[model samples]
Target: MMIEAAAKMAQWLRLEDGFTLIAHTSPDGDTIGSSLAMFYILTCMGKRVQVVCEHIVPYLYSFLPYAEAFNTPDTAEKSYKNAIAIDCADKNRMGKAVGIYNASMLTGSIDHHKTNTAYGDYVLHDENASATGELVFHLWQHLGVAVEKSKTALDIACSLFTAISTDTGNFSYCNATPGSFRAAAALVEYGIDIAEINRLVYRTLPIGKTRLIGYVLSSMRLYNDARIGAAILLWEDFLRFGAIPEDVEGIIDYIRDVDSIEIAMILRQTQKGDFKVSMRSKRYADVSAIAGRFGGGGHLRAAGCTMQGQPEAILEQLLQVSTDALGQ
Candidate 1:
């Protein structure tokens, strides 16, 4: 059942002595930032907590405050009494960490995804939130954290700023709500190192990921009179370029940025020897419905689903769906 009383969610968290905070697989800015923000909050309350993820925290995100708090499921100690998922839409997205999350005596989640499956015992979710970090900002109001600038406040604000900034495309995407801008403005008052964050989050790119970008551009495919664009990250590409899972984070958006593309997708070969597609739309196409057709869910503009098949055959199949979606 959906949790109705918002304060109860905060109360549930307040009552816990320790917690295992889980970030979804691939560890995007929103998930990592939300997890770290909560980590700071819970620690400040004298609670023992640790953040866990399925994979190594991406280098791009390691500069954030409490970046060292993340642990792989195997490495994380089992001392936490409760579990809470941050920014995860579903349990499967928790990857290997889902085992610990399931075993907790008390379970909760803080998420903004509209496709959330209500998998937690207590869920604080708002589909209208621009980012899960934004939801965390509001939750802090109830937790007795002052809005004044302090070291703790600055750290919290830095994480929240990254969460809101990256998820909303640096405040340029349509998802950037008034609340999103307002939260950013409020966070800015804490004096987060915005210039350094901009350089790390946007201006910096590792050589491996840089090379992978070249491969993606050179190998991109356009279909349906250039209305749809896609790039495939083959298994060999990982080995040849030494690119990690996080390296592929925003590659799909690059495909969608093209002027003629209505739908953009990235067909990636998962480490488990299966395939999954990350999708995005420029306008008007309900990609969540398309991803839902194959047991995936996200926002109208972005979504993804795992699949098992030959990659080439899968591309052919998705092209037909894209064509039908666009009435081409």
Candidate 2:
């Protein structure tokens, strides 16, 4: 029986069978955090499991526990008894990892995105969740893990905490519900270094990333009467700064932080010579719908898509989409 709750749905996995856990491609802290937390929980339950992704872990998240354990599709198992996507809104988000997930005998997902396509059997979707980790924390509770003993399993706590923190913007994003706060509070009591983790995730950055941020800020352009702001990055920009794809993480937040900017954007050139469009809204306007028009989906406030065209044309299309959305 699939209960509507994530914890109950999680019970559908058979302990006797081995399975694969997937993190979405270009994984963020939320996906990695939730995947690692589940990896620990399922392992402790004596279930054989592996975590896989389509890309290498970003350097900023490398400090996370179990971060080194992610397997790429080239190295993952041929098939599995079960597969569960962690924090992915849709199967497409799984990228190359989706192939292995599909080959499994059973499939499911645990996610908190509003734009979720609702794929997978026994799926658990909680848009109200501050992060997927909040639902994961409940899974811990379902398995009879006592809050008092949560500290004893430091890896589990750290992984869960990291997931919740990154998704909530360290409890600052509007998505942080009371339940989210409660989950984070309980997880931190498990002996994770809250200050150090925060410093690492938010305050600290590599020299190359810092240079990239400076470039983005200096090159930022405003539209829609200065309500929309964008920082466009060509492949050449990355080469000039010695920046990798990982370095582009969180660059959009800086633009979104502008007082007059309601919509912040990043136009990054992907390896395939195409532009990857990322959008974030401050007050209103569903950026996800705009991204969705281009075959992408995410939250109302944050979303993205990839486009193959001249940079300026892509930006104009996105602007038109955003303007139409804002008009509505």
- Residue 91, candidate 2: alpha-carbon lDDT: 93
Off by over 4 Å in 2: 1-10, 146-152, 215-237, 245-249, 260-328
In the range 1-328, model 2's lDDT, one tens digit per residue, is: 1245555565675344687999999899999988998888887777788999999998889998879999998898775688999999989999999999889888888899889888887677788888888888887777764435544378888888989998988898789888988887887777788989989988987777899999999999998887899878999889899899868877899999999888899999987799988999988888999999999999999999999999999998888888887674
Using alpha carbons, what is the TM-score of model 2? 0.74
Tell me the TM-score of model 1: 0.74
Q: For residue 148, give model 2's deviation from the true position in Å.
A: 5.9
Query: For this target, which candidate reaches the highest lDDT against the unseen true structure?
Result: 1
Tell me the TM-score of each prediction against the true structure: 0.74, 0.74
Clashing pairs in 1: none
Candidate 1, 194-291: lDDT as tens digits:
89998999989888888888899889999988889988888889889989776897888788989999999999998887888899998888788788
Worst 10 residues of 1 by lDDT: 1-10
